[model samples]
Target chain A: MSLCEAEKTFILHGVEENFRIDGREREDYRPMEVEIGIISHAFGSARLRLANTDVLVAVKIEVDTPYPEKPSQGKLDFFVDCSANATPDFEGRGGEDLATGISNSLSDAYRSSKAFDLKKLCIMKGQKCWKLLVDILLLECGGNLYDAVSLAVKAALWNTRVPGVKSVGIDGKNVELNVSERLNDCVPLDVSGAPVMVTVCKIGEYCVVDPSAAEEKCSSAALVVAVSQGNITTVLQGSAGSLHPTTLMDSLGLGVEVANQLNIALMETLQSAPPHFDVGFLK
Target chain B: MSRKELLSKIGLRADGRRAQELRRIRCKLGVFTEPDGSAYIEQGLTKVLAAVYGPHQVRGGRSKAQYDAAIVNCQFSMAVFSTGERKRRPRGDRKSTEMSIHLKQALMATIKTELYPWSQIDVYVEVLHADGGVYAACVNASTLALIDAGIPLKEYVCACTASLANNDIPMVDISYQEEVLGGPTLTVAALPMSEKIVLMEMTQRFHLDHLPKVLKEALRGCKDIKVILDEAVRNHLVNVGSSSGWVKNK
Candidate 1:
């Protein structure tokens, strides 16, 4: 969706005036709606819609042997699928590049042990562990994909329930574990330290958070910052154009501030909603 | 071949539904604004989203455009986490490609392609959840999306799945449990208003003598589904009409 020179000038002027095309302040985000436990097949799932950009994340747990180097910690894998329903450009292998970018950034954001502790997934240390597969699906791409995907992923992990191990037996070279059969016998993952990403787009001289599709097209450089517990876990510079050092520092600060507020708001929403509330695309 | 019976002694299926009953179908049209038309549908636990983009000038290149009719392009995809087991890829797999071709065939049969010559219509469906009858759900959702796009159609295209139980009783709308129980499934997509079948597919082989009955049952299910969809369209029209104040005709 290319814009004419006149349209870009209009958006540039809007950002400079502290008003966006949607009449939002530079720091304001688009209205968001999030639903938890939307996918019944997964152990935990979430769907988040930020205006038109929609993201769905589901966490599936499986039993596997821990990695030899990281024997005491379980695994966390992220997969992203960009659907053609979002756009014809995402058909077949067209969206592979974008999917890989998003998944890789998510892995980097969660790589820090302070941001996300993997030890909780361990079932029997090196012998057995719970492997969590976090799959993200992009149903629509209005704009601000990084923010929406990160928020949805955090919610999904918070809802995930790792089954309790009833017993573990070792016999020479073989190790066996019995998972609790009762549905209630499970533990929810602690997500207080999970990072929330914020994309700060540099438009004209000002940095705007949560840019719409048109706004995104107008900006040439941006910073994607993932914040966890008031600290920055990951900072990815996405610059199509060179950024001044001062502007880059300014944007990073703005990203962290916005991400912290977003994390608090997300936790409040998750806490207020009942566990069995039925909500999805229908609502 | 001894296995658990699909239908219980009381004639209830595994999901506590009757033999001829369908799973609950709840659908909404115009779910997304970016697409020319979009729809979301839930058939029990199976959910699907469909979007239609065109009837506009051909994209990518001009060589693919046909002069006589609007080209129908279809893509079928499932979310990576859609199934009980995580799928490695969303689309471009063998099964997804086959479903895409079948979807194109079914949609082409109902759409009035001659109205938009030298143009293309892009229909994309994504399965959010896959319990059973994923193909049937995609077809139904795409039909609604096409309608929402205001495309000209001969009639609504509906699809349904039917299977034989006890080698005699034909069942309508098989679920995942039923599909896994080792029964032959007959899937049919048709223009129910005119009782014309556009596509028919089967998974397993059954006795040739029982083919007609199962086929008949599936067609009947399609017709029933069409009625439900028609009612939904009328209700949607009324809601839209009232919102736009179209009922002020004196």
Candidate 2:
């Protein structure tokens, strides 16, 4: 999707005027739709579509020994898969670099205890604990991938339910856990503190949130800010272009402001969402 | 471990489906705008999404381009969380590579590649859930995607899986549980309109005498699937056409 020089200048002028190509203001976001518990086989799952960008997230839990260094804490791992269906460029191993970058940023954002507590996922100290594997699939890329993926991940984690442990038996060197068989005997995850990322793109002296693919191309640099409970968790600088110190700080501020608003809106939608239905891609 | 019956006394399968009945198939076309054509299909518990791109100039290098016919490229992938157990990788495994090759073969049989010389067509299928018959689901989903892409094809290509329930009774559309159980499964991809078999694969050896019956059942399943896909395509066209006012006169 290479842009011509004149086309780039057109986008630049639009940003300067604070009116985007899609007739949106600099701070406004595109329409988004979120669906939870769409994947029945997964412990938790979510699908989010921010304009044309689509992300699907699923969380699977397994019982495993805790990390030796973090014996008292459970584990949370993030894996991102770039499906070729999203674009032919992502075929074979072409998407690995992008997938790894997204997953790494997600892990970094969730590393802080204030963002997402790991102790709550612990089952029995160092012997056995629950491990949550968050798998994210990229079905479409309309730009603003960081923000879309993070929101989907948070929604999926919010929908996750950990099966209750009936009892734990320990004998010298062996530990056995009896998981409850009842479907409703489960503990839902607390995702109030989950971080939500916002990508603030610096386009022609102005900054914007949720840039469209074309807007993303016009931007020189971008800042990804992951906000959790009104606090910044992780900040990443993307693209090869350099940002001035003042501009970087300004973009950071904008990112946090938008992220907070997004978090509130996400919570409202999740809480008001009805029970699971079969409205996935069919809709 | 005690063996469970694949079919009940009254000829019902483990999932309460009759031997000839297929799992519920719900599908939608043009699910995404990024690709030239995209589709999502759910065959019972198994779900698959497919997207088709091009009939355009060959990518990567021109040396790979064919002067006589377009190169048909296919990639088969499964979401890491698609299976009961989490998968470590989505694609690039031996099984996925084999599936990709098989998909390409099936699609090539139906697609009119000679119409676009020195070009390429990319078909990608992603399995969101793998209850059973993943390969068949992929083929079915890809066919819809190609059609949505407006690619030229001789006829619709449909795939199905069949197995011998009790060494005598043949069953169509085997589920994951039945596949896990001991049984010989046969997969067939065919053009139902022309009654041409594009590809056939079998797992676990069965009596050669029973091959004809199993193959017949699998082909029948393919024909049935074709009907369903045809109906879906017509419904999609009618909706799209009327919405654009192109079919208003009719």
- How far out, in Å, is residue A198 in model 2? 0.4
On TM-score, the leading prediction is 2
Model 2, C-alpha of A109: deviation from truth (Å): 0.5
TM-score of chain B of each: 0.97, 0.97
Poorly placed runs, candidate 2 (over 4 Å): B1-3
Worst 10 residues of 2 chain B by lDDT: B1-10
Counted clashes in each candidate structure: 0, 0
Q: Give lDDT tens digits, candidate 1, residues A1-283.
A: 8899999999999999998899999999999998888888899999899999998899998889999999999999999998888888898899999999999999999999999999988878789888999999888999999999999999999899988889999999788888789999999999999999999999988899999999999997988999999999889987488789999899988998899899999999999977676657666
lDDT per residue, candidate 2, A81-191, as tens digits? 999998899999999999999999999999999999999888888889999999999999999999999999999999999999999999898998999999999999989
DockQ of 2: 0.95
Per-candidate Cα lDDT values, in order, are: 0.91, 0.94
lDDT tens digits by residue: candidate 2, B127-195: 999999999999999999999999999999999999998788999999999999978899999999999
